[model samples]
Target: MPSIKRKVLVLIALLVVAFIAGIIFSPFLRETTYQLKNWVGKPSPLPPVSKTVILYFSTPKGELLSPVERKIPVKKEINDEIRMVIGELIKGPKTRSLFPTVPPETKIRAVYTKGDTIYVDFSPSIVKNHPGGTSGELITIYSIVNTLLENFPSYSKVQILVGGETINTLAGHIDIRGPFKKNPEMIEQSKILNR
Candidate 1:
């Protein structure tokens, strides 16, 4: 009986050592163990949670912007979250009735905050690929500004930049040299699409 007890103790020790080694050396095993713990309801660092954000797009019939909801993974930092939001905006609206405001070729270069202002830097395509018009430019600019302001109320304004430098305009229509506040006048307040 004593020998059997010793054998069980040895087996337990071996398992503990193996578990420790797997966690230290094997990424796959570590993920599996984390998942197992989740399944077993054991307390573990929760997976990155997702939050719903409202993205603005141009309404097909008129020049006004419309809001659409999307689910995005929550980021550890606010700046990363801002990037994700803008990335989603570039992807365009999921609803058929709403038109995409940002140029498809546009790429986010950087996003940062200072006091109550957020600066969003984009690639040159935002200017080069823009459709070009007062109405079009208005829609595009407000689409980004409204999306950011709506999602993060803490940031009161957004400054648009291109290729790491501040730009005066997207397509020579609206003045973009200064930071922009949320223009509720440009938004279609009644309609909100979920996707």
Candidate 2:
């Protein structure tokens, strides 16, 4: 009985040592674990495919913003898609009749969604390079707010931020201290599609 007990203890100890060594020396096992983790919870590594997205841009007359159909790469993640949408908006409209609302030099630093509110962070150039007028600010703010709400129904509102900090206004006109909802009245009367 004593010999049997000793053999059992040795077997258990050998199993533990082998398990530890496998963890330490086996790269395949370690890589498999990492891949499993990513497969379960992380976004896919495959590049997002391009999709048609309607982006709102200020018209040349500045009377109201107009919708322009644009093809942009959209990711599986909603935040990533929002970032891509904003990046395309900054690139300006291809049509000569429409113009960009955000500054040409502005860069989107980050984009995130919390509950129904989407927060967009832009570089300081959004404010510094802005044309700074009531109409311009309204177009800029509404263009962003409308674009997000129009594209993704999951988001109800949008909050603009500069360098991750919220300001009272984008260009000292419209109050942007809180999230802004879509204003259908600000869109062009003729261009308002059934959404």
Q: What is the C-alpha lDDT of each candidate?
A: 0.92, 0.87
Worst-scoring 10-residue span by lDDT in model 2: 186-195
Query: How many clashes in each candidate?
Result: 0, 0
Model 2 C-alpha lDDT per residue in residues 105-161, reported as the tens digit of each score: 999989988899999999999999999899999999999999999898888999999
- Candidate 2 residue 188 Cα shift, in angstroms, is 0.8
RMSD of 1: 11.5
Candidate 2 lDDT (Cα, 0 to 1): 0.87
Q: In model 1, where do residues sit more than 4 Å from their true spots?
A: 1-48
Candidate 1: Cα lDDT at 164: 93
Clashing pairs in 2: none
List the pairs of residues colliding in candidate 1.
Answer: none
Range of the 10 consecutive residues with the lowest summed lDDT in candidate 1: 39-48
Q: Residue-wise lDDT of candidate 1 within 1-195, one digit each (tens)?
A: 999999999999999999998778899877889999888995678786999999999898648998899999999999999999999999998768889999999999899999999999999999999999999999999999999999999989999999998778888879999999999999887757895
